[model samples]
Target: MCDAGLKLPPNNEKLQREEEEVMHGANLTLKLNFPQYQSEVEELSVKSSTEVGYVKLLIGQRKGITAKNIRIFYNGTQMIDPMSLCDHLGVSPPSIDVDVYINLEHTIDV
Candidate 1:
């Protein structure tokens, strides 16, 4: 359901806007899960061109943890930074639903 006050753009204009977004970058909704934190889940809407590192930064800001302390996983495999969500998900669309796991218990030994 859309807001009653919200008005959709004209067909042509809407098409043009969509084309522009496709040319630039689309947005995606990702499910961020914190398995160690009560199975907490949060929905993150970000541009497809966004990197996993940025997502981690966002999550860290929300969780009050350092970005370097967060680990991201997709489909049970660890995700690396510098990889766009579009390339990671391998989908072409403005909207897509994907799940990502967050591990906060990772420790680094100096």
Candidate 2:
């Protein structure tokens, strides 16, 4: 429930090393929450540049849900298809402490 965004410590060697690794195109680890399922995906590794739509697709595939049925929200704002994590959070090379909400669409067939 932290909305403070990413806070980089001053000259923290461990964080510095991790930042360097990410700068070399290392994937970012995200904590994905699925409220309806009452579950969470801890440590979901993804590129900072990856699109929100693709992230939904990836999660959908893994969770056995349809990509079109997924909706992602950050900081109370709904994340659209083209926005990347960097764009949404407005920072990169991150140990981003943001919580993402996943809304699963419940469908009914006639």
Candidate 3:
């Protein structure tokens, strides 16, 4: 597992252009579901350029959990921290509504 808080400089112009292109004409929304908690479903309005790890941090603050303890899943798979929300959704303009599951269980190594 990689550090979720790692930050990288935008050294490639092509990547920046691609990111802007995906976010050009759409509003992104991330619907977060917490199965183990009673909190009502939370929705985050974001851009396609938004990072999944950032969303996890926001969820952590709202739920009183550490950001490292939060795991985001889209379409039943874990999301990489550095990937943008749009890439994870794999839509050209991205869906206005994106659903992500929040897992709070901590992993243990034997």
TM-score of each: 0.67, 0.59, 0.58
Per-residue lDDT tens digits of candidate 2, residues 1-110? 97899886698888886786567444676667656656655456777777888888887777666677777766667778887777775445444434444443453223
User: Using alpha carbons, what is the TM-score of model 1?
Assistant: 0.67
Clashing pairs in 2: none
Better of 1 and 3 by TM-score: 1
Full-model lDDT for every candidate: 0.70, 0.66, 0.65
* Candidate ordering by lDDT (highest first): 1, 2, 3
Which ten-residue region of model 3 has the weakest summed lDDT? 91-100
Runs in model 1 deviating more than 4 A are 1-11, 89-110
User: Mind giving the per-residue lDDT tens digits that candidate 3 earns over 10-96?
Assistant: 699878876776555346667666655655567877776677788778877776666677777776777788887767655334343
> Model 3 segments beyond 4 Å from truth?
1-25, 89-110
Highest TM-score among the candidates is held by which one?
Answer: 1
How high is the lDDT of residue 33 in model 2? 65
**For residues 1-110, could you state the per-residue lDDT of candidate 1 as single tens digits?**
75789687777977996887777577677777767766677888887778878988898788776678777776666678788766764545555444445453653325
TM-score for candidate 3, please give it.
Answer: 0.58
Angstrom error of the Cα, residue 42, model 2: value is 3.0
Q: Which has the higher lDDT value, candidate number 1 or candidate number 3?
A: 1
